[model samples]
Target: MIYKAEKFGEKYTTRWDNIDVDEILSSERLLGNYKKCLMDQGPCTPDGKELKKNLPDALKNDCSKCSEKQKINMHKVIDFFKDNKTEWWAELQKKYDPEGIYLKNHIANNRHGDKNDDKRDDDKKKEERDEMEKNDNKENSR
Candidate 1:
């Protein structure tokens, strides 16, 4: 059984950010475990099982009748990525990323980031040249 988010939830504007994880196993026992990690209180399901221990055969046997529950879980998956591909994430990405120049290209209304990037690079090169000139001046004075 394939646990597809599209099977339950509304289609998201952007594709799911499957940076690391992709599909959820529809096998009831495995889904029960993932639900445990995403929950805050009580068991992952109303039956009060599987979160701390494996679900009984009755609860972990199938998901044919789990449309609503699957929808709710898929919605959570989308919300979990709410900060992704947004301005806040773009800022953080440019700061931590080394090579990928995605912020200005992908983000909307982001001339500021590109402008600042160019300015910083120019300033760095100018600073290096100025320091070299200072060294040369000191050698001449000596």
Candidate 2:
């Protein structure tokens, strides 16, 4: 799981700023441990726990609290998963973005280059509208 640095008071601690992201991504063992930790399938290191605690807020707010360096690192992690570890990326999205809200933003931002993404989003919106119309019609009949 990519840790989107969260603000502690004014900014997230810079203690992790110098972390070698490439080193971790290259090591399957290290990355797997993080995946397990984030998925609640294994014990968490302190930093992993902190990251889990912050993840929901970061996702909801588009990492608004993240520093520029943290945002850069987050994007690097996201791209790595998308390009090299697509299945794992899907798992992460299923867990964190179950409603597809964040994924829509990613597609809108061209983070994922799938041309059909917009059509899927449009279909979902139409389905939602149809459901709402049905509910309104039922209410009016009653």
Candidate 3:
């Protein structure tokens, strides 16, 4: 498992692209371990550590450095988390997208053919706006 970035050129190495993403998605234990590793709540395996290191750049750049297979696998993992593990997904979002900079792109790209996802995202945006407005009102009154 050559996880080092040194060998990477224009795009990341494809060494780990063949990982069984569906197995991880479907296995509670594997999913939890990955979540913990990603969130720094538990120790990371070598591959997990590599993923953690690369995740921020991947999210920020919309996986621009990913190979096509990597992109598909990444989308599958992300969509699974978003749909099945909301709490873990929110934690990841808070860490990776604290300011919500990449959130719209994420939602737009990972809709997974679900129309209700758009409505969910819109409702989430409205709630966030409402919270921000309330905070502003409180600050202004001070």
Query: Superposing all C-alpha atoms, what RMSD in Å does each candidate have to the true structure?
Result: 15.5, 10.4, 8.5
lDDT of 1 by residue, 36-140 (tens): 433433245322232123211112232223244433443333223322324433433343332433322322223444455577689999999999999999999
* Residue pairs with backbone overlap in model 3: none
Give the range where candidate 2 is weakest over 10 consecutive residues by summed lDDT.
1-10
Better of 1 and 3 by lDDT: 3
Arranged by TM-score with the best first, the candidates are 3, 2, 1
Question: Residue 111 deviation, candidate 2, in Å?
Answer: 6.7
- Tens-place lDDT per residue, model 2, 1-142, is 3353434555555567777888989999999988898888999898788778877776777666767776667766777786688898898889988897766665565544454555667889999999999999999999
Clashing residue pairs in candidate 2 (N, C-alpha, C atoms within 3 angstroms): none
Question: Lowest-lDDT window of 10 residues in candidate 3?
Answer: 1-10
> Candidate 3: which stretches are off by over 4 Å?
1-8, 110-142
lDDT, each prediction: 0.38, 0.74, 0.78
Off by over 4 Å in 1: 1-101, 107-109
Model 3 Cα displacement at 142 (Å)? 50
Candidate 1 residue 13 Cα shift, in angstroms, is 11
lDDT per residue, candidate 3, 81-111, as tens digits? 7778889889998998788766667667765
In angstroms, the error of model 2 at 16 is: 1.0
Each prediction's TM-score against the native? Answer: 0.30, 0.68, 0.73
